[model samples]
Target: MSELNALHDLLKGLGDEVVRSGERIVGRRNADWSGIPAVPPLAVLYPRTTREVSQALSICHAHNQPVAVQGGLSGLAGGGCTQAGDIALSLERMNTIEDIDEIAATMTVQAGVTLQTVQERAHEAGMMFPLDLGARGSCTIGGNLGSNAGGNRVIKYGMARAQVLDLEAVLADGRIVGGVRKMVKNNAGFDLRNLLIGSEGTLGVITRAVLQLQARPGSVATAWCGLADFDRVTALLRLTRNRLATGISAFEVMWPGYYEYVLANVDGLRAPLSARHGCYVLLESVGGDPARHQADFEKVLQDCLEAGIIEDAVVAASDSDAREFWNVRDAPTAFPILMPRLIAFDISFSIADMGRVSQDCVARLGARWPGSTVLVYGHLGDGNLHVIVDIVGASDETVLQVEAMVYGLVEEYAGSVSAEHGIGLKKRGVLGHTRSRADLEAMRAIKLALDPRDILNRGKIFPDELLTRRMND
Candidate 1:
């Protein structure tokens, strides 16, 4: 039979409502937040249950059909983007909170449930699901697990993988594996749960998860501090950690470019401090004792100010004030509106090397593209740094050149090419910059073992030549 005939036969059993093709799939053909060009898939599948997902995958697997898994599509990487002739398996209709055990401090939810929904539910139960990001309102739990996402509180609470106690996923050949186990310690065998969490759907499709929750903080203290330079910024971070200990939840840094750009372009965002410094830091601490936490938080900032670790600072007096401070840090959410053609990078370096690396990157990019604007900010407590370069009237070649420069620098510093975002289509070729050849080989071996047909998320993670070779083999 022809390929088209085989695909038709494979999808025949799946209901029409579950399978959308041609014009019906138009809305699914937009690029993810990464802004890569999108290709419409041959069909989009919305499986409501695990059994339906297995059935659809079984037929597709029998016919050697390729499938691309999609979640909320809020990813900064192009992992979820589909290509021509590929089936887009989306988890939209599978959104349902199965159970919440306040006593056990765990929530069982389907992969399609939004992060904000989980957080809100946890809050309603007087608990907290700590994995958070700007895309929480739209990004799904499955995507979070797939990418092993590290968000604002990674320094304290850790990544999405850390929050997940267990998960259930469907393998490439339509075999369902794993279970939503709420146990904290399970040494039964190899850790399949963690292995699938960061596999980015190449190995399996995450269906449901049991997430660990934290007790809700009784009080949160937020402050915006201006520092003379990166040295002062690091000093403040060290001091904050030393004094606040585990109470520190977020320690975000903003260079002048990022801090100034947001206040200028984004509406309703105002400067927290009247005076401008070399860089800015927005730090938050969460504690059970309200008055005591506030006093300790202020004391740390005061000590920093006295020691010249911070030049000027403003402690948020109300929730509205805290939101105002975070608005500046969260301004990147408006990048699509403010600057559509921006080249963004989410990278990491050693805590000690981050300042030097960031400075060198800004200077080098500035010298290379004199007119380009380079904005830098990130979770300094962790090593993640978000850099965005926007050049006016630049060509595609320019974008590639910029990537080469930035990634080359990342390689030079021995830093990660992608800190939180997974190596989707955008960073596939340069993945070797961070990972060694042996690492690549091991990853490829794992992929081949899990998806021998190379039918799951083809042309993702691995370099093109590697994937092409695997397919030919």
Candidate 2:
């Protein structure tokens, strides 16, 4: 049968309302937040339930139709973008919080539920779902799982995968695997849940997940500190980790460029510190006692200030004050308007080497693009640093040049090219910079085993030739 005819038959079987074709699918074509050019797909499938999803995928699989899974469409990576001749499978309609077990400390939610929704619900239930990012209001649980997203609290709570107790996914051929098990430890066979969590939808489409929850802390302390240099930043981090231990929930670092840019570009944001410093660190601690924890938090900062480990510090006097501190950290939310042509990199390095690497990256980027604006900040405790280079009207070739320089440094320093963000189409070619040839082969083998026809998110995560050659064989 012709490819067009096969797609028509598949859509017919799924019914009219479940599928959107041609002009109706225009809105679904764009890449998620990466600013990559869009490719309109053949159609878009909106599956309202797991059965509907299975039915849709079954038909597409039979026709050898490629499917691209989409969640909230807030990803920085291009993993969710649909290509020509592909069908976009969006989980937006499957949003439902099925159950929340208070005693078990688990929340069972459909894949389409937003991270903000989950956080609000957990707060209402007097529990906490700790995986949080700047895009939490729009990013979905399924997207988070697909990317194994790490966010502000990863130093304490870990990544999105760490919070998932159980998961349910639909394989490429429309076979449903996994169940919503709430057990903390289950040593059952192959562990498919872990296999699919960070696969970026190349192996399977995540439909639902049972997430682990933690007791909401009764007291929270937040502070912003100014440090003279990277050494003092690391010193403060070490001191807090040793003194505060697990109570220290966040340790975010911002270089001068990032701090100054946000203050100048983003309106209604006030500087956290009175005087400018070489580096800034936003620290937070959560505990059971309000008065005692506040005293301890303040005392630690006081000691650092006295010992000259920190240049200055401001302990949040109230919740509003705390939000004001975070406002600066979350300034990237304004980038779409402030700097639309920004080239952002989410990479990781060892905690000891991160400062030097960040400095070297800024120097190299500045030397290459003298007129560019570079902003650097991230969760320093977790070794994830975000480096954003803004050059208006940069051509495609210029973007490639920027990526090469940044990724070259990543390879030289033995750093990961992608940290929390998955290696979507954007970073697929440079994936070998971090992973070995054997590693790539193993990953491709798994992809082939799960999706022999190369139908599920075909061009994501792996370089094009790796899978194309194997399928041709």
Candidate 3:
């Protein structure tokens, strides 16, 4: 077929080690992580260096071949999909740790480095990589920055983009742009790194990056506290932050229903404490001194109890115990395995409006689907909440109805439909609810000017109607 011949020639052009076509799996995985996997691509290009990436992209641009830039393929959004006739450019072979600037407290790494590898390697060198998540073992630095990922410690260390210093990416036209040097203070021009960080590889392909590091933590204190209501949780957060200062790194909240669901279904896990509380908070504090940190933690707990801000609290006494305390809140394996397919969403609202919006959303979900179970929880300190609506044995129409109800109410509350995950293929239709017309127009213009051929991850971020059908598609 002409398609095979064309793909073979493109691969041959890249070099013997760079390309592969037939009988090979390429493109991004589906949203469910399996169902409806993206249609196979014309070829998969695995470039090992910046120059190779440029040349391969240049060829694709010249041919007007739609290409998807993939890092770890761990993204939940379908940003990396490619149908027949399209191509995939993976940074898999580009893994490398170029340097770790100890003096500057920064590390420069290629985009393909696994996040967990960075964390462990940096820890071994007596530094800390604060950005972490359940998927760190598989996710890549570029993927993290692409989604502006916010994990457990986001309440303290900020998002992935905040922890980054600089980056190097190849634009759609095969032009390399951005700086790689570590700069803490640069007012010379626009903050270009921020633009590339959360773009989901739509505007360009991330090749290399420099990340900011923090001092190795000397002490850690974790606790699972029970709260009478969300108001108390907010008050508890304020009280702890006021007392502990910046030492508070993680503040995770869980609604009672969620905790109960996990305990009922998850094996090898028991409810550490009674599951009757209206709300539960998992708080962690990291500091430079162990003794003082532990004392301060207890004192804060006692103060909160006396002030009626907290009902009950159990502080972890050992490292193993601390992880045990967090497992209940962090693991979502049980939810998906035991419950029916749920419409899960991560929405961010101002801290002040969290209680009202969550309550209204829950009431609406219950009314819309009586059999559906609604659970709400999140990082209270950061104003980002995770909501799940379970539609057990529901029809496709029912599932869509629940989604409409949740997202529609979220917009009314002025909350983001996606707090950290990029729009990608999954949320393209709902993007208008989150971004304004002017915002999307500017984004489209930037995509056009930089990748005029529409060769870089085409038909993503923007809707499908915006583009004329690819001649070959």
Candidate 4:
């Protein structure tokens, strides 16, 4: 029988978990959030348990059918997008909170569990799952692990990898490795969990995760500050790090254009401070004591103002006010509506180079794509800058040109092509810009060793042309 026929036969035994309907398996099932064209799979498999996942993979492995593992579908890159002849292995049916070890301060969750669910459950248990992002409502814990997501709380709790104590992933050949290991210290042997955490499903299929939870802070003080420039922003960041230290939860920065664009375009989002400054920084702190947290937050602002590090500042009077401040930052979701063709870049470089880099980028973008709007904003705390370019009526080639221009500049500045977002299909072609020859060789070696047939998440992380070229070189 044909591979598709054999695959269908194997999935038939798994019951309704397998979606054979061609139409249902197309569209979003084969698309990531990147707005790229979708490549529909032969079918989309919804595996409810690790055994089912392994069984599905076992059959696929035997048939030499490539598989694309999908979770929340909120990825910015095209990591989850399926290709022709490929089968999508979605963990949506695996959604569940297996256990909450309150004593150990860890939450064991299935791969398909939404981040918001994890956060809400942790809060109900008087704890906090600190891996938060704008897409937390839709993004899955497994997707977060695959991307090694670094969200708002990275300044304090670190990235998703840091938040994960251990995880269970099914190898390409259906080998289930790892389970719930809640201990923070495991010096026993090679860290396989770390390998799969950020491998972006190219290495293995993540089935479940054990996430480290922090004690829910009694107080979360947020402040919105208008800064003159990136220098002042860095100064304020240093002050908070020196004074508040681990208490600083988030330090997001937005350029004037980004601030103005959001305030003007996003309804119900009023500027907390005047948008006349060169930039703005939304600072937040969390601590055990409400009164002390607020006082410390206010004192830091007062010091920043006194030192001329900030032009103006407004501390959130209540939770509502804090949400309003974040609304302005998060309002970029209205980007699609605001601009016809928006090209985005998420890059990382030296924090000190941020001011010059963004300014240079904007200037260059304007010259290259005249009348295009460049809106810059991101988690400056960790050197991740998210740049959105408004190419209202640009062609496909124009978008590629914009990518080359921006990423070329990123490379010139010795910055990573992708910071938080993984090197999926969107950025795979440019992986060489950030990674070295040795790095690429190591990654290829790992991929070859783990999935020799390239049956797992093929057409991702490394472009086929580059892979061939590297091997020849």
Candidate 5:
């Protein structure tokens, strides 16, 4: 009751966009393609401009209130998530593509602009903003930069962070620091933009950004192939990069279990060949001419089959067919047989150790949690794999065990516990797998220096000291 009274005047003073009570529901809303339950806040405030955001943060910093900055809510990790006694700062009202610089090939867009909006705007202006994920339709540009999101073309265009030229963010002290420059080269001291990009809203609230744009793909071709095992998958990846010698936009691999689940249940999304195999990959190449790209793709697939490196192969006959093949890869419904409550883990390892590490993780998952399915697949070309530890029930106890089993093995393999998904609240305890104690303490030191009062997305990335204090009780 006292907390409400204390925040009432401050929140009410911010204008009609800010609210204290029912605003808490902002956190309860699902924000990602992952569909994890949201950890909500006590209030939510939406500000249209950096000035309004500054005013909101000023009150929050003064009150020492924990604040979670929410974008389009499309992150896999709970970076934008809020907890009790917390307030959520919303950038939804800030959605706008402010300017398009044709010569410089950059777009200054407000943080809340949906990725698709930016993409289409770039397309209409005869350019491309190549940062893409399956969730591009609803995910915000700011959220993509926050998580340093990687998607199909990551091997080529790089992650979202690399595509960002500059950004404007509101720091913890309510000071609006605008760093929106569209320069390609600047050896100007420390790069503050990179610091805020992957900090996952913990360092500051990103309000606007100048994003780099690329030349649009004039032509693209895709092929599907079934592999013998993870070893064969890696070998084929090497072959594709070496022989195909084209723009490989995507190299998505699916496990036999995952492939079968799609083939069985997802109607209209057809598998390229009827051959049953241990793994399947949907490979893509892009170039200037569709005919040359298609012929080259067919030749590559034929060579793989001749080498007996893979079991079977099929190239997409048309654009529609290509989307159908990729739909099976992108959509969750394509893999319906996967347990409803599963821990999706993405880890990176050297190509040499990937097969053994994957096998070890699967065996451990089955032994640790009997009757649960373990689906393994990845963008093998980039040494990234996705492991899903299927649980019969998603009870807290069972999920924790699955997380430990997967992450512990990841640590054993010397792989990052998180590949694309940034380490938010869920992976805080397991970060030790990827880094040493000194590394983490140094990160904490940086955090403390950036946010002295620790009001910006307080409990995310790092475990909360207050929570520790309460647990000691």
Candidate 6:
């Protein structure tokens, strides 16, 4: 019998658990939110338990069958995407909240649990799961850890990796390593849990996690302010931090083009400011005392406005109003529906270089693609900016050119190629621009040690030939 046929026979006992039909796995095995075309895997495997996952990987390891691990399929990068002859492993069945310790302020959950579920559960327990993102309803905790995701709350709660106290993962060789620690301090030895958290499933398959939780904020305040320029925006950030300190939760910024595009394109969303400006900032503060928090927020806004630091400002009068203010900044519907053919970018740079980099981006994109539009906005509080280039009828060549131009600017500004998003197939080629030669070599060494067969998320982070060429160059 052929290898494929033999593999199928060896796994036939899985029955309905093993998805063999092509039609059923159409969108199931694809990477989350990625625009890349999906390659049908040999089969999409569903393992309900860690041991089951180990069993499947053991069989695949023996047969040398490559595997791609997928969670919510909500990732922009193609790291979770499947290739030919690869078996896709979906963690959907493993969704469960294993434990929620109110006294300890921690939650132990299966990797397949959606972030939204975790958040809601934590809220019900009078705690907050601080790791939140736009894809919370769809993205899984495992994927969040795999990508080391950061969202609006990251400025306050840190990344997904920070929120995690301990985790459990299945190795490429089907060895289950469980380290579900609940203690706040364990300074005994090396942190093996961190190795798999942001490894993008290239090192091991994450199955469960023990996440640290924070006390639910009793007071939440939001404000929308229009800024004269990036300098004022930074000043506002510094002032907010200096005054409000740890109470500040979010500080989102949008350039004129991005603010205007979303304002014009997204229906039912109105601008908070009366007049257009060069920049817009949405700030949120959370604290234990509602009255004190609101007073501090208003005082800062009023002081900034009186001091000529801000052009205009509006504090959210109610929860609904705050949601509306954020809707404009989020642009959840605008970007996907209106600008369907845009190249999205998420890079981190120094706060000081933002204004120049954004101006250079707009100028360069316009010079090259005469009619193209560049939209800029992001979590400015953390220096992670999101850029979208809208070029009409852009071809493959045009995409390559635009990517190089954008990433080139990021490199010029001494920025990272990717901020929240992992280095999937999309950003694999340009990773050298951000990472050093020694760093790349060390990462490659880890990948080789963990996955000698190269069976896990192959061709996601860094390609061999490209790494060698970059090192040589």
> TM-score: which candidate is best?
1
**Candidate 5 on 1-473: residue-level lDDT in tens?**
54465367556767554564564454357344445455556667878888888888877777677788888877778777666777778888899889999899999999999999999999999988888787888789888888888887887788888898889999877898757888888778888888888898888889999999988877788888887887788778878788765658888888776777666766677667777888788888877777777788788778888888888887888889888888878756444344556578878887678778877877887786777777777876666888876676568888887887778878888888778889777677777889887787777777777777788877777655422432113
Candidate 1: stretches off by over 4 Å: 1-6
Off by over 4 Å in 5: 1-13, 18-40, 331-338, 368-370, 393-396, 464-473
User: Positional deviation of 100 in candidate 2, in angstroms?
Assistant: 0.8
> Quick one: how many clashes does candidate 2 have?
0
Query: How many residue pairs clash in all the candidates, one count each?
Result: 0, 0, 0, 0, 1, 3
Pick by lDDT: which candidate is best?
2
Cα deviation at 101, candidate 6, in Å, is: 0.7
Q: Which 10 successive residues of model 3 have the least lDDT summed? A: 27-36
Off by over 4 Å in 6: 1-6, 9-29, 464-473
**Per-residue accuracy of model 3 over 403-451 as CA lDDT, tens digit each:** 7887887788888878877777787877877788888778887777777
What TM-score would candidate 4 get against the native? Answer: 0.95
**TM-score (C-alpha) between model 2 and the true structure:** 0.96
Give candidate 2 misplaced runs (Cα > 4 Å). 22-30
After aligning candidate 2 to the native by TM-score, how far in Å is the CA of 51 from where it should be? 2.1
**Residue 390, model 5, lDDT:** 64
Give all candidates' CA lDDT scores. Answer: 0.89, 0.89, 0.81, 0.86, 0.78, 0.85
TM-score of each: 0.96, 0.96, 0.95, 0.95, 0.91, 0.95
- Least lDDT summed over 10 consecutive residues: which range in candidate 5? 464-473
Tell me the tens digit of each residue's lDDT in model 4 across 132-213.
8889898999899999999788978899999999999999888999889889999888898999988899999999999999
